[model samples]
Target: MIQRFIELGEGYGDIFEICELARTNADRLEQAFIMYANHNDKQVASLAISLKPVGDSKFMPIYLCREGIPYNAEKPSQRLAIFEEALAQLNVVPNRFEIKHSSIFSENNLYYQYLIGILRLNHYIPPMH
Candidate 1:
């Protein structure tokens, strides 16, 4: 089984795309996740949707809106609000995790690898076969 993160840019206009994907692929949708990380002293979030492999493709695509939305307690960002609304409409609750910033790694790919490890360790995703 192969699992990969398909980044759809930050939570700008791409957030709508994420919502659309979830709605369109409802059957394949496995779990929705909200990952919080500190980036440059700012609290940001990455919204992700894990999809089960389609048919026998063995490719599990994890759609993501990388760290962009400000995770403010006083007032949430529009992007975050939209994500919440979409999940509510679909009756899907996302699993949230607060993690260290991606900047801890020298490269972006390493950051993703770290995230994959964390998810696997927590049983959010299956381990390697």
Candidate 2:
């Protein structure tokens, strides 16, 4: 199957959109994830929602708010809190992963490909058929 990341704007608003997408498509939702990475020595996260492939379509869409939130274990922010609350409503807790920051990639598409590889390796997304 083909998998791709669809990027949304960064912040709480985008997180809400991601959550809504998952909630609305819960039957087809494969996984909800928060990808964390260090950029410029600061922690940042991207919220992603993966959906199952449609009939005859190998492509799976992964919606994301790319590298926007500050990642802190001890400190929390309203943006992340909203995501957590939304996930609770959907009855699915997000799976977290530390990854290579997108900034390291020269192109945005490459960054997404890297993420897709990670997801496939983790079995979050299906492999090629």
Candidate 3:
């Protein structure tokens, strides 16, 4: 199966969209995640929404808000808090993972591929079929 990341923006704004998607497609929602990374000594996070494949379409789209929010572990932010609250309302706890910054990759697509590998390895998403 093919899995891909669809980048939104960052933080609560992205979370809002994710929440809406989850609420609308509650049946197909598989997992919600927050990808964290350190970029030039700054902590940031990306929101993700994973959906199950439909019919013959083997692609699983993981919607994301590319690294933008300050890591809550280092500093508290209202944006992060709002995202957490939204997830709570959806009854979907986020699966967090620390990862390398996208800036390190030559292309954004490559960065997404790297995240897909990590997610598969961690069993957050299914392996290729």
Please report the candidate that would top TM-score against the real structure: 1
Give me the runs in candidate 1 sitting further than 4 Å from their true place: none
Tens digit per residue, CA lDDT, model 1, 1-129: 678999998846799999999999888888899999988778999999999987788788889998878898689889998988998898999999898887788998998888889888888887777
Candidate 3: Cα lDDT at 27: 79
Number of the top candidate by lDDT?
Answer: 1
Ranking by lDDT: 1, 2, 3
> Which candidate would rank higher by lDDT, 1 or 3?
1
- Cα lDDT, model 1, residue 38: 87
lDDT of 1: 0.88
Q: Looking at model 1, report the run of 10 residues with the lowest lDDT sum.
A: 120-129
Model 3 lDDT per residue over 1-117, tens place: 889877787756576787788778777889888778998878888778899988889989988877787785856677777767777887889998789998899999889889989
Which stretches of candidate 2 lie above 4 Å from their native place? Answer: none
lDDT of 2 at 6: 88
